[model samples]
Target: MNYIIIKDSQQLTEVCQKARLADVVMLDTEFVRTRTYHPQLGLIQLYDGEQLVLIDPLEIDDMQAFSELLSDTSVTKVLHACGEDLEVFQHAFGCTPTPMIDTQLMAAFLGYGLSTGFAALVNDYLSVELDKSESRADWLARPLTDKQLDYAAADVFYLLPLYQQLLEQVEVKGWLEAVEQESQLLVEKRLKQVKPEQAYLSVKGAWILKPQQLAILKIIAQWRLLEAQKRDLALNFIVKEANMVEVCRNEMTSLKEMNEAGFDHREIRRHGNTLIEMVKQGQAIAESEWPAKITRLMDNPAYKQLFKLLKDEVKLASESSGLATEFLASKKQLNQFISWVWNKDRNPEQLPDVMQGWRKEIVGEALNKKMS
Candidate 1:
């Protein structure tokens, strides 16, 4: 395999120009982000048939040319599980690749099980085994080892053939449009960042909290998010949600109380005072000023019944299709569907927008059948 290490913007631009002439470009990125909410991009690997180029973002200042190439409508970007990689590009280069094809999603759509890891896919489709041992290698380390380079090259090298195989399967299955639509939406979705205030909605314990506690959790979560971004560290490193929930429920104010509960003092030592202040501020807020009460979906019997039916439908569809149910629809989407079904005021005509494309074709029919 001919590998080109892109050390600066000029090389990156030239390589991208060469890649743009190709019909499809196999793309993969090596990033480290265990320390922060956002990933730190270390190496970007691109392959266009003849050459594999590895771009060192640390040395490259002007990524505009590469960004434009990514956004080029003429070329297709082939990747496996590229959502996070797309997010990295959007964050760093201010653009997301257009006309992208995610093999992970395509695999599922083509009746391959969901959440298929890269190594497994390569082994299955290309019959070429990959080394998973170096998955956690420090990409930021200087003087890349031969093994690391081989691993990186392997990612894009087999991707070209895999993409072709998946594309053929999708076309033969008459799901090319559906898969393409989903892939485009994935790129669009990755470009937008969720607001910090709405971040609390995703916390596992939010549903159990009372309105006031939910409000306080929201504020504290937002503060913690900002702090993490500023310090460039993981959110859990600052304060795990489990610990935060405990603090909120117990109303712990002092570091001594927090430590007594088995919370690591060393981790929170620097942010301890700020965390305390946040808690104090949360406690001081008027009860009426808290967020509106969140109604529990499971409380409604009809909704619960619909939720059960949806799960069964998903299971049946997944089994018949040879895809994973979790990949087809998430538990959150199940809940949302239940709510949508129970809401008499929601027009079925508008349902397509909320639940569109392949999902509509697969589960929508069953939903309509049940509702009717």
Candidate 2:
């Protein structure tokens, strides 16, 4: 396959102009995330119907033209499993490609199963074998091997054809709107980083912490997030979660107990004072200000029956709709729905995804009847 390697601003501009004229553009990205809070974009692969090109982001001085092309509303951007790629674009250009459709999302709507790999989708649709040997290649290295370039090229080469078939199936099933809504929601969520105050919820084993402990974790998590972004270091490199949890659990106040709190002396000299102050502040929090306990309906035997009913509804709905079980109604969404129904104190007006949109048409009403 013939592919152009674009290493300069002039070539990128020319490609963007050509891309603007095309009806659809297929895109993929290669990046490294081992060291930094944000992915370091190494390469970008683009296919505009007739042309296949690899643009080296590390070589290009300015990416404004390419970024503008991505933000273009006129042309549709087709990608497969695009969550991380979208994140790369957001970080690189400060804008996300729009009017986007993910082949993976369409495949699920067409009943191929959710979370299908890009290679599997291509092989299933096009009868082409994709070489993933270079899938873990060091894209940031100065000289990329021919095999590596071939691997990158293959990602977008078959996407256009796959998009066409997927599009037809989605249109036939009358699910184009749902696919678009889900894809758009994903893009929006990726673009909007979670707030620092809400970051603690993302910490592993966070739900195990008491309200006061959670308060401390939240402060430390927020500080760690900001520091990671500033220093371009991974969160674990800054402070391990287990250690942070330990400090929170014991309410460590001084650097004297640094080792006992599960943090090393090096970590202590760097962030001990600030972390201790956050602990003190968290310790001083009023009882009313502490976070509410997270209660699960699954713990109750009475609610267990209700949970089984909801699960059965999801299984039946999945069979009826020809959608994957998880796609139809994830366990988390089902739990939320159950909570809404069983707990009168929970908001009925606030429906989970399983209870809204196309899902409402799938199993929501039936589940609501069961509750009634």
Candidate 3:
């Protein structure tokens, strides 16, 4: 198990040069993010057709060449379950690899499974049992062990072979373009930053708040977003959602009031006044400016029956089209569809993926027929 460790400008330059000439390469990253808003990149693993290398971002001074290769349009970037890896690459190089192939998505496209792991894919395709001992290694440590190196290398080493097979199969099924479109959209979303004003929508239990309380929740949530980004801290590190919701619900106006509202956090003591100020500003907002109360579809017997019918339609479509049921529409997506049809005001663009693209042709028509 031999591989090169690229820790300097010259080694990186050579790797980038070789990568540009290659038609496709496997990519993976190691990072730690338990304490921060963004994962701290520790290692990047790459596999050209013949060589495997690990790039140590902690030791490398310049990454421009590698970044260029990532953004290079001609080279196909191969990865597995790339949601978090795409984020890591965006943060590390301020760019995302394009013309990508996500083996996980490809597997789903082939009706294998919705969220297949890399090890499972390897076992299914190549009969290799991937070693999992170093999967949880502390990659940020100064010296990554040989076992860790082997594990990391194995992540990308099998990807190229997997990609070749998947490409041929998808092309035979006439699904190559559809798969690429889905992966491209997924990468673009992972690379985009969430807007502070829209951050409240991500807070848990937000839908339970009344219109005015939701206004306060929005203000506090937005402030938490900005503070988290500024300090490179997790949102909960600044203020937990429970405490933020409590403050907004009770209209806590001071540090003493925060305690009275049952919000107890050590970090809150440091920023209690700011939280109160945000609540006060939110309260000052005119009634007309308050957001409308979120309308959730009730779990009534009648609506439940409709949801069941929709699921039946999805299953029928999956069987007819020979696509994975999970890929066509998950239970979660079905619930979203019910909410949109019942509420009538939810954004059409935010509708489930089944309602658009190739999925619409396969499953959405059946579901829509049931609705009518």
Higher-TM-score candidate among 1 and 2? 2
> Which pairs clash inside model 1?
35-233, 35-234
Error of 1 at 63 (Å): 1.9
Clashing pairs in 2: none
Model 2: CA > 4 A from native: 254-258, 261-269, 296-303, 339-351
Q: List the global CA lDDT of all models.
A: 0.80, 0.86, 0.85
Per-prediction TM-score, please?
A: 0.91, 0.91, 0.93
| lDDT score, candidate 3 | 0.85
Q: Pick the TM-score winner.
A: 3
User: Which candidate number has the best lDDT?
Assistant: 2
The residue ranges of model 3 lying beyond 4 angstroms of the native Cα positions read 260-264, 299-302, 338-352
Residue-level lDDT tens digits of model 3 in 1-372: 578999998899999899889999899998888889888898999998877999999998999988999989999999999999998888778888887889888888888887889999888888899987887778899888888888999898888888888888999998888788789868876777788888887787887889899899988888899988899898888998888888877788878877766666675678898887889899999999998886555545677778877888888888987888878888877877776666665467676666777887888767866776
Residue 154's lDDT within candidate 1 is: 83
lDDT tens string, model 1, 103-133? 9988988667667888888889888888877
Candidate 2 lDDT, 169-285, residue by residue in tens: 899999999999878867876777878888787787776779988888888999998889899998988888877888888888888887765577888888889889999988888
322 in model 1: Cα distance from truth in Å? Answer: 5.3
Of models 1 and 3, which has the larger lDDT? 3
lDDT of 3 at 271: 83
